[model samples]
Target: MTKTNVIRQLEKAGIPFRTAEYEVDEADLSGVHVARQLGQPCEQVFKTLVLRGPKLGPFVCCIPVAEEVDLKKAAEAAGEKKAEMLPLKELLPTTGYIRGGCSPVGMKKKYPIWLDETAELYGEIAVSAGVRGMQVILAPQDLIRFTGAKVADLTIV
Candidate 1:
C-alpha cells in the first residue's frame, strides 16, 4: 500500500487500517462520489469537515458521505453557541489539508473532532487518507480512540 502521512500515523499508533485507491476527478471531488468510486455504500464512507465555531477557533467533524452536518447539533456537541463551515480559502492554511482530502487523523493539529453517532452502526468505515484518490478503512471505535473524537448526533437524519 502506498503510505501517506495518515497511513503512517495509523501505523505508528498500532492502528490496523486497510487502504483503497480509486481514480479521482479533481473537478468533481465529493464524498458521495468517492463512495461511488470505491464501490462502497455512502453510509460506509465518512467525510471530514472543518468548522469554525464562535467559541472554538476551529474544530473537526466527521459524518456519513450522504448526510449533512447538523450545525445546531454540532454546536451543542462542541459546546459552542454556533458552528459554521470553515471557509474554503482558509481550509488549507488552518487544517493543512485541501478541501477534498481532509482526514480526521494526522491533521496539522489535533482539533477537537466530533464523529456522528451513526458511525457506531458499522464495524468499519472509510475516510480520506490525507489525499485525494486514497481512502482508509478501519473500525469506527478505533478511529474515535485515535482521534480522541467525541461521538454525537452531529448529522442531520
Candidate 2:
C-alpha cells in the first residue's frame, strides 16, 4: 500500500478516499479487468484518457472502462474542432503518468478534465491511484470538486 502522489494529493485536499490494490496483469490492463478483480461493476471503474487538440493543447477525459471516448464529443467539450489521443511516448513527459496508471489527479499540470456524466449514477467510483494495480475509491462529487472537472457525455453511445 504505497502512498502515491494521487493519494497524497487527496489527503492534502482533505478528501476522504479508500485505496484498493490488486495483482497487475500486464496483458490485461483494462479498467473492466481491474473492476472485476476488485469485485466491482465496470461502470464504477473509470479510465483516464489524455487527448490533444490543436487549440486546446491537452485535456483529460474520465470515462467508464467499458466505453470508448467519442472524439467528436470530446472535441466539443474541449472547445476544439478535433481531438486526438496523446501518444504513449509523450504521456509520461506530458502528464507524469504512464499507461494503465494515469490518474486524472496529480498530473504535471492541471489540464482541464471532463468526467462522463454517467458517473453521477454511482455514489462512489474507482480510478487509478497514480500506479498500476491500485485504485482510489471516492465519492464522485468530491472528485469532481477536487479536480474542477466538467461532467459531460464523453463516451460513444
Candidate 3:
C-alpha cells in the first residue's frame, strides 16, 4: 500500500496507526459508506470538514460520518461570531486537499482543528488517509496530540 502524506507524517512523529483500504465508489463518497465497507460502526469513521469564519479565515472540524457540525458551536470554539463551510472551490487551495480526501493531519497549512468530543468514546477512529479509498486508524488521543486538535461538542445533537 502506498503511504499517503498523512501516514508518513504519523510515522515520522512516532505515532502508531493502521491503514484500511477499500474500494471507492465515486458516486458514494460519504463516510457512512466507507464505514460500511470497513465493517466499522459509523461513529468510528470521521469526515474532515473545512469551514471559514470572516475573521478566522479557515479552520477544520472532524465529526462522525453521520453527524453534522453545529456551526454555532464551531464558531464559538473558534472565537468567531459565525462560521460557514468553506466553498468547494477553495478547499484544494486552502488545505491542499480535495473533497473526499481531506485529512486533518497533513493540510498545506496548520489551521486550527477541532475533533468532535465523541471521538473519545472509542479506542480507535478512522480518518481519511489523504486520499480516496484509504483510511488511517489510530487512538483519538494520539490524533489529538499529534494535530494539536481541541476537543469539543462541535456536532449537532
Clashing pairs for predicted structure model 1, backbone only: none
For model 3, the run of ten residues with the poorest summed lDDT: 22-31
Model 3 lDDT at residue 25 = 97
Query: What tens-digit string does per-residue lDDT give for candidate 2 at 1-157?
Result: 7999999999999999999997899999888889999999999999999999999898999999999999999999999999999999999999999999999999999899999999999999999999998999999999999999999999989
List TM-score per model, in order. 0.97, 0.99, 0.98
| Backbone-clash count (model 2) | 0
lDDT of 3: 0.96
What candidate 2 gets wrong by more than 4 Å, as runs, is none
Cα deviation at 25, candidate 3, in Å, is: 0.7
lDDT of each: 0.92, 0.96, 0.96
RMSD of each: 0.9, 0.6, 0.6
Candidate with more favorable, higher TM-score: 1 or 2: 2
Better of 1 and 2 by lDDT: 2
Mind sharing the TM-score for model 2?
A: 0.99
Off by over 4 Å in 3: none
Score residue 104 of candidate 2 by CA lDDT: 96
- Candidate 1 has a TM-score of 0.97
